[model samples]
Target: MSAIVLLVLGLAAMAAGYLVYSKFIAEKIYRLDPDFKTPAHEYEDGIDFVPTNRFILWGHHFTSVAGAAPIVGPAIAVIWGWLPAFLWVVLGTIFFAGVHDSGAIWASVRNKAKSVGSLTGDVVGKRARSIFMIVIFLVLLMVNAVFAVVIAGLMMKFSSAVVPVWGAILVALVIGQLIYRRILSLPVVSVLGVIALYALIWVGPSVPIQMPTEVMPGLSGNAAWILLLFGYAAIASLLPVWMLLQPRDYINGLQLFIGLIVLYGAVVLLNPTLVAPAFNTDVPPGTPSLLPLLFVTIACGAISGFHGLVSSGTTSKQLNRETDARFVGYFGAVGEGMLALAAILAATAGFASVADWQAMYTAFGSGGVTAFVQGGAYIIHNGLGMPEATAATLLTVMAALFAGTTMDTGLRLQRYIFQEWGEIYNLPWMKKGAPATLLAVGSCLLLAFGAGGADGSGGMIIWPLFGTTNQLLAGLTLLVITVMLVRLRRPMWYTLAPLCFLLVMTIGALLLQLRTFYEQGNIFLLLMDIVVLIAAILVAMECAAALKRSRAEVAAEPE
Candidate 1:
């Protein structure tokens, strides 16, 4: 099969999803009302609740959620064959992610921009909020820790990426100050910012910043980079929305757009043959089965619980109008699916032949990451006639930027969770945002530096669990949204069906991983997996009880 055929097919499917299915959802289900006032206006605080342009907010939302997961997951899962990964990315985006993301934003907007964590009380009853918050906090801990390590690893392995990543941050700070405080127009800032970004990309290889023990005096290599990155995250998390997070993500969104255009254009011009098989009945030794693992492995590109967090936690608070939720939320999911499509295409067709592809994906450790980077190099080299090494370095820098955006956002959300918990537990000091911020950053540090793999790869120790936790969270988010819909007297089979399927598949994957951990005598992972399972079961039980009560109330009402 030709790569162009697959690319066209995947893009067409996504267009249909957006035009037909998402439109049906918007008109029939959500029924977004333009007359409805959004929380951005009701609150109207310049700090976090300021009304934002829908296009800008979409950039912020898409870039933050896209991260490395969409790229990494599909790259890894293509080992099973491109067919399974393709189907999941296409159908899953429409049915699962679209429903969850848009519904989450809608629920949050109607509830005055409360996060999904806090809104659980209204939908599932007040008792469920505490448990839901705890689950959310733990899930975020994993996100922060893993992302920090991932960023550090990239810096250590690809020194050239360090300059562009940090350079982008510097650019964001200057742009944020000039535009937000000095009243510069977005068009001027955007053009200037993009120009500066390409300059950084060009300068990265020439003057790469290398991490050393001398920088921090005791920490070296990955450890040194990890500490510095977390420190940056701490500062970034404390700044107001306009200062860092929003501007940096906007820049990242541009970078992603450029990368996508280059890759897709290459596919059209080069028309590479699919080097990877469409179906792999000949399973490799020690590889995971295609059943539940593939679903969990490709969680983000398909659907992620984390998307609901961004939708409800931050984006919902800044929406200018209620009707824009479909554009921001549903379209954001489709955008991510496009990124995943790029990943699948790169992994399947970027190589010259089957043997070359197999060599890059022989095992499931770091091979997938290498393949994605190298495959991307191949595509760029062919498409634009750039040197492969330079293209690979450019892609690495882009990937690191994606991880940085996700990390700070996760940290900020974690701070919010901590503050919420402080109030629930009657701790007055934790109510102050500073203390919660410190605590959140501190926990991420401990996990990233202390409990990680022996070479300062703490994220690796917990990496295997990330997929299961992510999918489980997605399932939980969908379930809560279903309950919210029932309360609104809306039809919910669309939400309910996906929720049921994800729960069953995710639970099976968790158990399979649990057994793997036990067999390997990895007690720490075993315990973590057990705790996640318990949390899932408890949350599911609460949803069931709430639904039962809802049914009884409907039955008793005069019809």
Candidate 2:
């Protein structure tokens, strides 16, 4: 029940798992032979395929994995209880996430630094490669759509009379990049940019930015917001990475890191008691049991399918040494788990009444920007010397920065996947040497359509679907890693432990999703649930087939 105890236990579990268990997996199973040549060395291109310092690579990996999902998932999970949320994150990351990420990096490295799709095909079976690609494409589409809505909703909530703080920060970032990277030697430009960012925050309330008052008469604000956000995503996807996505992510990462520090520092300074119940006895009639829903709700922080794409798509190609993959991949998973822990701490600490948290949740429904700002403000007001309004505004700025970072990174990743998808599908219109600008634009449009809200509400209908798909992708990644471990002849106990845990958790979650869809009777959600269920079954069967084939091959070798 003690927050400190839980924190210590969680951290300890993560450390032991990564240091002891993961290292064992790396040495015995993955066996990154020192003599083996990595793809980065074999095909060293300056662009996308260059070797980089392990530390720098770690930075890139961490920045890519740590995003709005980490923040949002934990924030919501704590609604059930910090205990369930915290435990799932800790245990899940240690066993499920860390292993999956580490294994993925190793798999990619061992297979000539190919993407997971390519590796799956080469190692498991040719059919696996196609499955991997299709699964990833769908997952990317859902991920980008969900995030687009999240950012748009935040923007709509926060927009005011003065220049939009997020917009200003974005502009400043572009200008800073131009000055430092392109124009060269303008320290003042960067300094002025920072000052301008803060000033815009100060003046945010006075500035007026247009928000659609009514996208459709019957549509809820959230729905309308989703549509508009996805619409923007479509456009953003087609643009050059540098023009918006990369710069935004850099700013976002900086702000998120700083905000986390501030929040954690305040938690330590205040040492507030844990007031929420450790478990909720009265469950809603239709909600899932703790066994599965907990894992599903905390997907990103614990383990995410998205990480596989990141690992194989970019990080694997840039790894300088095979040994570095474990550090970058496993450590990155732990870091994300810790971020979820921070959110758990924030939601659980200092509040005497559940009503207080409920009030914030409701406010989030109505006044998205103000709700988070006020939540942060409330924490500061209770724990520090800052004025409530000032604290709220400061927190709001931080939240905006965080969202912007997520949007930028998410959009860029979406763009990459879109281009790859185009190539794979062999779209004639997307011929070689086509302008990067054209591709960016086209990708953005595709994303916008999916992210847009149904019924002209402008709120995204895709998010619920996205959540299911995202978790499904994670399950698929875990399945692949498990097969890889088996192929490498890892210790049965070591490979089976995490593999079995994830299989149960993910499959249970999928079933629960199916049940929910049937009860809700939402055709779209139901269809997604069915698709995920099928994917889950397919992943399970494929692993079984691979394992059987490997066993037969071993028997025939006469060794």
Candidate 3:
């Protein structure tokens, strides 16, 4: 297939999902209320609970959830074939992610804007809440570890990206102050922000920041990069939303769109050919089976549990209207699906022929990003006449910035989980910000540096598990939403089917991973996988019981 055909089909499918499917969900299932006073308005704090415009909130929510997963996951999953990845991304985004995200927003908005973690207690059972929180904590740890390694690897590979990526952060700090404190209009600030980031992009290639081994004695490359990245995450997570998190996300969001536009425009002009096979069961030695593995591998591009965290944990708190959840939640999911599609196209069409494509798949580690980045650069060079070096630098900056956004958001979410765990367990000290932040950051540090594979590639070792755990969390979140719908006496089949499907698939994936990890004798990952499987099963049972009771109640109601 020509790249244009694939691109057009993917774009058309997403647009249709947003227009028809999402509308049905908004009106029939979620029944988003226009008049409902959102938590942002009710709380009205300028810190975390400030009321945000729909567009700005969408940007924040989209960038937080998009990250490297959508790009990296699809790039890797295409190892099986583009057909499986493509089908999963399109279908999963509509049926699974859109529903999960929208339900999270509705659940939180109705329950004082608590996160999925807290809602597990209120909507399901208290014990289920604890289990759910633990699942979240583990998932965020994996997110932090994987994304830290991702950014570090990108920086080392494309040294030119460091300046633009960091420069964007500094620009965001200024933009945040202008918009949040001075009450500048979003359009005005956004236009200026985009312009500033583009300038940084232009200047980045000339001023690369290389971290040599001698810079930190024993630490170099990924190690030094990991430490510095986490330090930034720790600080960023603790700051108020308006200061760095929100504005930085907003800028990254724009950069994401710009990158997409450039990529798609290149596709139109050059019309690259898709060299990857449409369907291939013959993966390399040690590759997992296609069934459950494919589902988990492409989680974020299609359906991710992490989206529930961003929806309920942060976005719900800032939503100006309940109705906007449809736009921010559902559309946010569709946007991610598009990003995944672009990754698929880049990876599949990156090579000049079938042999070259197969060669690329052999090194799927950091090569995942390289596949997309190099392919993207090829398109830009061929179509737009931009220098290959500049195109690569620009794309790398966007990818690193996306990862950076997700890392800090993950840390912030982890902090919230830690604080909740502390309060629920009667540890007053944990409820305080400092201890909780420290605990969250410290756990990430231990996992990223200590257990991380050589040079902290530990994140790579557990990525398969991370994907499965993420879907498991999504299943748990849907279970919580199903119970919430029951309490509201509303139709829940929309949520129930996806819940069952995800839980079963994730469990299967987990089992498959357990055998692999056991054989490899990776004790830490094996133990982590075991704990996640047990917790997920327990949560599923509670949700099943609650769902059964809800059905029973419905059957017994007066006719």
In angstroms, give how far residue 544 of model 1 lies from its true place. 2.3
Model 1: residues with Cα > 4 Å off, grouped in runs = 213-218, 453-455
lDDT of 1 by residue, 1-559 (tens): 9999989989999989988998888888888888899999999877778788787788788888888889899999988889999999999998889888988898899999988988887778776776677668777888788877778888888888888998899999888887777578888888898899989988888888777635555556777777778788888888888888888988888888888888899889888998888887665677877889998899787999999888998899889888888889999999899999998998888999899888887775434556778898898899889899888987887778888898888888888888877777889999887899999988887777688643456767877988888877787778788886776677979898998888778788888989989989999999999988887777678768887887677668776
Candidate 3 residue pairs in clash (backbone atoms < 3 Å): 452-458, 453-458
- All-Cα superposition RMSD per candidate: 1.7, 4.8, 1.8
Give candidate 2's error at residue 103 in angstroms.
Answer: 2.3
Residues forming the 10-long window of minimal summed lDDT in candidate 2: 363-372
TM-score of each: 0.96, 0.80, 0.96
| Model 3, runs deviating above 4 Å | 363-367, 453-457, 553-559
**Per-residue accuracy of model 3 over 1-559 as CA lDDT, tens digit each:** 8989888888888888889988998888778899999899999777778788788888889999999889888998888888899999999988889888988988899889999989888777788887888788878988998899989888887778888888888999999999877768888999999999999999888888887744555566778788889889889988888789889998888888999999899889989898888986666777777898889888898999999999988899899989999999999998899899989988998677889888888743434678888878888888789998998888788888988998888988998898878777899999887788899888887877677644776666666678888988998889988887776677888899999888889888889989988998889789988998898788778877878876787678875
What does candidate 1 score in Cα RMSD to the true structure?
Answer: 1.7
* Candidate 2 lDDT by residue in tens digits, 33-65: 656778888888655566755654664566566
Candidate 2, superposed: residue stretches over 4 Å from native? 15-22, 32-37, 53-55, 160-251, 358-374, 393-403, 406-412, 415-459, 492-496
